[model samples]
Target: MNRPHYILQPVSPLFITLSLTGAFMLNLLPWGRWIGAPDFVALVLVFWGIHQPRKVGIGIAFFMGLMMDVHDSTLLGENALAYTMLSYLAIMIHRRVLWFPVMTQAVHVFPLLVFTQAIQVLVRFIVSGRFPGWLHFIESFVAIALWPAITWLLLAPQRRAVDRDHTRPI
Candidate 1:
């Protein structure tokens, strides 16, 4: 079955802010320390970075990372560094990634998410000399699984209606 191609409307900056804030709130929930807990912020960051690189680029990602760092009480620049790198990489390949189907985009995203997690783990390991175990990487896989749903949700606001009413001027 073929999917309908949408001519997406221009994304509102307010919607982007709200979505990022919502992701941050989700990250603040108590389940964050669980073995496979997905990183909502990271997911949202990647989404915006890929879809709206001009509006949500490395600076925004770095800011979000600093917020995460403060929340997690880890090293000051750990998440900032990771997210900055993630955003940079995402922006670098945003055009290429956007050409693929959602599933293929998720495949492309998986490595980016893994790389972010790896950076964090590497930082922590250097600081504390301890490994958090292989399960730490599961979070990236979980995030990848949510990619399609997230894409649908985030893009919903920008998608033009499938049934256009000819009488009305948009």
Candidate 2:
């Protein structure tokens, strides 16, 4: 139950499109410390990077992050910077990392999230002259723990694509 596997397939562009939209919705949802955590954008990005590397990449991540930054009004390029780093990691590791069990890659990806956020924090600190609350880092923990399940949900399209033998070369 702790481990995850990437069974590659072609997923509907519709699902991918919806997933991207859903991520933004989730990102915008208001939440307290006791409820859900940060946006699942990176989680979706990671799954696509592993399962559909050709479809989702740094450009998408950067754009999504940029949108998020604009939506949240945090600083220009803050989320974009973090998202770009996450995208870079996913693309770079997609080939070999895809072979690893889902949980294994999640473990590795946890730091990429943290590191990216760390950069975001550093940049924020430089501009704002203060740090975000400790709970802000909590998103990393939530992301790693939630990776497998989120990955599973996005896998639907992959399976649908594969079922129809529409897998494109990654």
Candidate 3:
């Protein structure tokens, strides 16, 4: 099967901010406490890191992570550390990740999401000496499942129209 390649337009900083904010808002919902609840912030951070590394780098991830730490009331800097590392790794692999289709990209992303959660769990275990159990890792799987849809949604604003009008001259 052949896929039409789209020449994406330049991404707006405002859109990036909005998407990150929206993901943060999604995390604030009541269902966040449930097991296997996907980390929206992590997902979006990775997305932007992979697609626009210069625009969304370690600093942004760290800030978002700090926000999550405050919200969760967990050990300070826990999320920040995880997000920072995640962003770094994403940025390092961004070029290679972009060559794949969205579905394949999800395959590449699964490890990153799992690593993020593992860092959180490791921090919690070190601080409290309690394990959250294997179920905690399910969130990564859920986030991976959402990867393709999120890719489409986030890229929609940057995608140029497929049809060209003859009245317009290049």
Expressed as tens digits, the lDDT of each residue in 97-129 for candidate 1 is 999999999999999999999999999999999
* lDDT values for all models: 0.95, 0.76, 0.95
Counting clashing residue pairs in each candidate, in order, gives 0, 2, 0
- Model 2, residue 35: what's the lDDT? 33
Can you give the TM-score per candidate against the true fold? 0.94, 0.82, 0.95
lDDT value for model 2? 0.76
* Candidate 2 residue-wise lDDT at 80: 89
Which of candidates 1 and 2 reaches a greater TM-score?
A: 1
Write the residue-wise lDDT of candidate 3 on 1-170 in tens digits: 57877778899999999999999999999999998899999999999999999999999999999999999999999999999999999999999999999999999999999999999999999999999999999999999999999999999988855567778442
In angstroms, how far off is 165's CA in candidate 1? 0.6
Ranking by TM-score: 3, 1, 2
TM-score for predicted model 2 compared with the true structure: 0.82
Candidate 2 on 29-129: residue-level lDDT in tens?
77623433855777777667666677888888899989888887889999888888888887787787766776887887887778877888898999999
